[model samples]
Target: MRATILMYHMIDTPVTPAEVRFCRTRENFRKDMQLIREAGYHVISLKTLLTAIKNNTHIPDNAIVITFDDGLACNYENALPILQEFGYSASFFVVTSKISGFNDFSWDYGFSCRRMLSTSEIIAMAQAGMDIGSHTVNHVILGKAKTQIAIHEIRDSKAMLEDALGHEIPHFAYPFGSWNPTVRDVVMTAGYTGACSTMPWPNRPDTDPYLLRRSEIKGQDAPWQFRLKLHFATNTMPPITEMRQLTRKFLEKTGVISLRKF
Candidate 1:
């Protein structure tokens, strides 16, 4: 059966990094989660995805694998509890280098802040039944880097997580949802079973495992918007990818400086 994985960033709260504008607020996030619950989609972990795809096991008609990028502290503080309450499982692909404390955040936005999850917080989440994977030691756009650098980013990250968690970190995510065929080969060599990309659409049974597509969830999308995004791309390039590329080009042409500030 086909499945969808939703990628999200910050949940609602205040004190966002001056540059991080996509942080979803708690009120809206709560509403979205509620909507998910109402929709009857089973919020599952990546393990379920792997198992179903590999074994062709029977799964619910609508299954979703939820993921949180950057390991935000708010994911532990705000999102985890709600997830537990909802009996929803999610995966957190952590940046091993960012485990120093709760104060260090990603450089994705124009500014930086302490929003990512700490080692202790991550451990707690894992113990509480969340799946952990590698997002990299730091978030790097592997598609743009040299092969050697890409290998280090992809391979070293899984190693780092294994050392920390004392277990295999079998899954991955592209730092920016960016990948090329070379990048995919490196990830496979790094020993990851799968790597989720920011492709943004429903994945079919014939989907590529190494370059698994995911639905990019933003704080701004309502249930209707999510539905449309999940269904827009079927046989060709995903709508989310097309939308992102088009939006990027439009922004570049118009000199909006919205997504480029970071």
Candidate 2:
């Protein structure tokens, strides 16, 4: 069976005007959960879905996996309650270095700094039935990093998170969705059962479990647009990703963009 993994970030006041595109309001988030139920989709944990796929077991037709990236405080303060209200389980991929730290994982291009989840909050979420996966120790983009550096990021982050939660951290999400063959190999070697990518698509049993695709949920998306996203696989995400990549290349070539501070 095919399954959709929906990606989310902040659910609070936009850190910047541009971020509003991805930051959903609390009311809209609640309604989104309602719509998922109304549409008859069963919200399942990433671990459960991946286990079913690995075993070639049957899953419901309306299966969905809810995931949040960056482990922001807003996710703990806002999104968790709403998910609990719907009795849904989610995987939150956290930047282990940032938990309980004041710094956030800033997008190389966006330069936004937001509060990350605290260590206590992460533990609480795990105890409450949410899966805590590692994003990285420092949210490094493994595609560009040296091989040893990338491996350390993947291995050490998992160790740190498992220490915090007192359980194994067996899932991951690529920082910035920037990955290549090398990055994929390191994640698997580091022991993750599966890892998520921002690339938008539903997954089948044959799909690479290490590079699972996920569709982003935008803040500006209304109910109708959300419905369209669910109904249409990939939809506008591929073209958008392509355009963004092209733009990045152009900016770098023109010396208009450079790597930002970690």
Candidate 3:
């Protein structure tokens, strides 16, 4: 019952140095799909994963769930065709307020602001058998935000997305993978069946549905690195990653690196 969930953000060539960590080139994405096929893995939808978790049933071995965050236009324009070619299903966690608009929030994080999916593109993907989930209305970091703000971000985004797609948005992704127990409760109380967190591990039967773990595939990852992450559920040692993150935060806080330029 162990399953690995792969998280992606943008699907295009990196235009800026900052974008490299989150953006994957189209060719690499296709190659990753081919690698999945070669590795004897089964790509499952979020709905399938959630249903199994809810019903306490068996999930296929080597199950991998693909997901994209931020609703970037390249997801529809570049990622979708390759996914269809592989006959695989993926879940997209979109920022509801940014649909059909540019990702202004990314600019604050030093990422090149990019266009987001249009309503038509989202509907088309949903019709084509993809899962559409919420990444919140503004991609707010729920762990640090106030309780009411977290509630609004969780509930309103689901409502907005459901209204747009004319169906229930059953899952959510914590923005920047930030969440606490209170935030997790809000997601469940909002009626979502499951939620994703960037915990960098494969999920097992006992895993919390609201905090399902994911491994991110970065843009600059070599094929071997990708394979390592695919097999190990993480590309780097946890302590090393934590140190790097702490250092980055310290630098940002000390005005050593501006977030917009970091």
Give all TM-scores, in the order shown: 0.81, 0.87, 0.89
Error of 3 at 159 (Å): 0.5
| Residue-level lDDT tens digits of model 1 in 1-262 | 7687878777754454552345677776676678777777677678878777777776775777888887777888988888877788889888777775543444444444665677778778878988888887667788898899889888888887777677788899988787899999999888888889887567666667777877776655665676654445222334567878887788888888666551
Residue 169's C-alpha lDDT in candidate 1?
A: 83
lDDT of 2 by residue, 1-262 (tens): 8788888888887777778876989998999899999998888789888898899888886788989988889899999999999999999999988887754456554737777899999999998899999898888888899999899999999999988888889999999898989999999988899999888878888879998988788888878767656655453534556767887888888777877411
What is the lDDT, from 0 to 100, of the residue 19 in candidate 2? Answer: 83
lDDT of 3: 0.91
Task: Name the better of 1 and 3 by TM-score.
Answer: 3
- Ranking of predictions according to lDDT: 3, 2, 1
- Please count the clashing residue pairs in each candidate, in the order shown: 4, 0, 0
Q: Model 1: runs farther than 4 Å from truth?
A: 14-21, 101-108, 230-262
Compose the digit string of candidate 3's lDDT tens values, residues 1-262: 8889999988899988889999999999999999999999999888888888878899886999999998999999999999999999999999999999999999977887789999999999999999999999999889999999999999999999899889999999999999999999999999999999999888888889999999999998888778767777883534557867887898999989875654
Which candidate, 1 or 3, has the higher lDDT? 3
Worst 10 residues of 3 by lDDT: 235-244
